[model samples]
Target: MRPVDEHVAHAVSLMAPVDLDEVALAEAFGRVLARTVTARYDSPRFDNSAMDGYAVRAAEVTVGTRMRVAADIPAGSGEPPALHSGTCARIMTGAPVPHGADAVIPVEHTDAATAEVTFYQSAVTGAHIRRAGEDARAGDAVVAAGQLLGAWQLSAAASAGHATVAVRRRPVVAVLATGDELVDPGMEPGPGQIVDSNSTLLSMLVTAVGGVPVVLPRCPDRPGAVAAALAGVDADLIVTAGGASVGAYDPVKADLAGHGVEFFAVAMQPGKPQGLGTVNGIPIACLPGNPVSVAVTFHVVVGPMLRALLGAVEPKVLAAPAAEGWKCPAGRAQFVPAVVESDGSVRPATGGGSRSHLVASLAAGRVLAVVPAEVEQVYAGDTVGIMTSILENMG
Candidate 1:
């Protein structure tokens, strides 16, 4: 029996980041940057009008002074007549301010004509002009390595002339759901058979965490099939959702051992019987068959390992508050499904038996409330450990 944190640490340490690849800007979102992204050109590139206005020399706009309109500059048109002495140009939003124009008086403040314009107010130098490089300068660092790309970041990168981005490769994980009692959800099962939801549920979760999920053929209760599957699957990581316990049919442990897999298990309830090993140098996470058990173990134990394998700079645990009062048994860590409310509060969700493979509770839950082995009693608002699905709100 080992501590849960120790198990997590071991899994993370055993994994390494995948290689880097250059992907199109559209495909780079949610991937960690493998190299620093510097700006190729300054944003705004040149001084431009911030609104529909008259671009004129600041010196010409004395109190109530009027100037003639020389030309119109609409956005995206390359050229506009240069501003002459005592003259202005009709400039639209994002249009480059004409040369020799030092200020922009908004259209609301000026009346315009093809050859003349009336300024209702004085203008200050550099007014309403977005200077070049105001947002980002050429060669300036826009994004650093190891940073996760968001929509806004991608847009900025594109604007700065990055058509493709180098990001840490997403790990390919092969999923093998074991157990003879487990049956595909769409198929009819014999007596004592159960639907196989672990693979389906876990695959989505893995993709959500930025890991690739490969569903392999189900392995039977026999050790031979488990060993063959473990040996034959090709992936950076392998996840099996059953046959990790001490049952007679639990062949995952012995099969992985035959392949020289190395790892340990943690002492925790509902998820106590789990395994972590490596077959053919590929990390293997053998999870319990119970629905809630596998989900909790994935969140607490496997998620971090996946991130580490993907080269995430900081592998974070999803945490929130406990949903309800919890009493910890003598020795094992307890994981309970809980709803994380909008107000940053957490409350328990139903379905917690080890044998009951209830995925509905997991779908409704926003967090996984954790009760450590040292904790004997837990009450509401006690600041318990939490693993939140809303990664942004976890902070």
Candidate 2:
């Protein structure tokens, strides 16, 4: 049997980062930047007012000093006339400060008169002013390459004068669920049958990791079904659940065995049956049948692959104290769907710990509590490594 880390590394090796493409800033959210974004112009663009007040020369202003409001300067107004002595500009926030104006007294600190404003407080030079390039300078790197574009990153990119950015294209993932005993969700399952929840689970997981999920038609256990459904399909990766085990009815193992897909007994509980290879030039990953196994394998193997394709770094594993104790599978690594509490302690999401078929527990799980193969038990308050979901860490 292969070690868990070996399988994860092998699976990720099958994927390559997608090509870089220029996309509009509006459509670049959640995408990874392929190139470093530099500032086109100085941040703040120009010397502007940080507050709605009168722009004045500090040396000329004192308590009770009345100055003539020479001009009104609202935002976007171009180049007001230079301020002469004993004169001030009524400047709104974000308005460019007039030349020779070194200070701004907020409106609250003066009489609310526009034409002839009276200041009750003294002015300080450079107060309430946003100097050009204060935040960043032109040609400075604003957003580094490989950074995921989010609201804040996008805002910075736009503020740096970028209308479009070069980012890695999102990967298109094809998801297929196999099992003769499975039916589509919402339909009542007959005796000895179950709903095909793995499809929905895999699809949602794929999307959460920044991949476009194309849910393929469900495949049965019959010969050639898995291969036929995958024929002529176009995708960056193919993920299939079920039929990779050593069962007589495992079609995924049967059909794709000699065609480059290698099945392995990974040293991990609930997700030991793993298959990874290419089918028709598209990388395919076959996970175990159970829903919990699907979730675990997605985090351990598939999520990293999708992240790699997007030029995204894998999420850092956090170490937190276990809120309770649990047993682990001997000689096989365990990934228990668990929740990290607000107090930074971790606990199982369900009472049935590490059960592969506990589908409902997945909804409550925020992270996967990873245990080494040699560790047989986790006592209360013992520190454990956790792999958080990508959705939880997205900004």
Consecutive 10-residue window with the lowest summed lDDT within model 2 = 386-395
Which stretch of 10 consecutive residues in model 1 shows the poorest summed lDDT? 386-395
* TM-score of each prediction: 0.83, 0.90
| Local accuracy by lDDT, each model | 0.79, 0.91
lDDT by residue (1-395, candidate 2, tens digit) is 89988888998899899998899999998888989999999998899999999999999999999989999999998988999998999999999999999998999999978899999999999999999999999999999887878899999999999899999888999999999899988999999999999998888888777789999998989999999999999999999999999999999999999898999999998899989999999998999999999989998999888878988867788798999999998999888889888899999999999889998888899888988899999999998999887667566
Per-residue lDDT for 1-395 in model 1, tens only? 88987888987887888899999998898887888899999987988999898898998796678777778899999967778997888899999988899999988886655577778899899999999889998999998787678887788789889899998888888998988888888999899998999988789778877778999989898858887876667798888888887777787876775465543557676678777767877888888888888888887778888878766555455555554576766687777677777777677676342223667777677676767787777776677667666243222
Residue ranges of candidate 2 with Cα displaced over 4 Å: 60-65, 393-395
* Alpha-carbon lDDT of model 2: 0.91
RMSD of each: 3.7, 2.5
- Model 1 clashing-pair count: 8
State which candidate has the highest TM-score. Answer: 2
Candidate 1 backbone collisions, by pair: 318-387, 318-388, 319-386, 319-387, 319-388, 320-386, 323-347, 323-348
Model 1 CA deviation exceeding 4 Å by range = 27-31, 56-65, 79-85, 99-102, 109-115, 119-127, 148-150, 257-259, 262-270, 315-335, 351-357, 370-378, 384-386, 390-395
Candidate 1 lDDT score relative to the true structure: 0.79
Q: State, as a TM-score between 0 and 1, how close model 1 is to the true structure.
A: 0.83
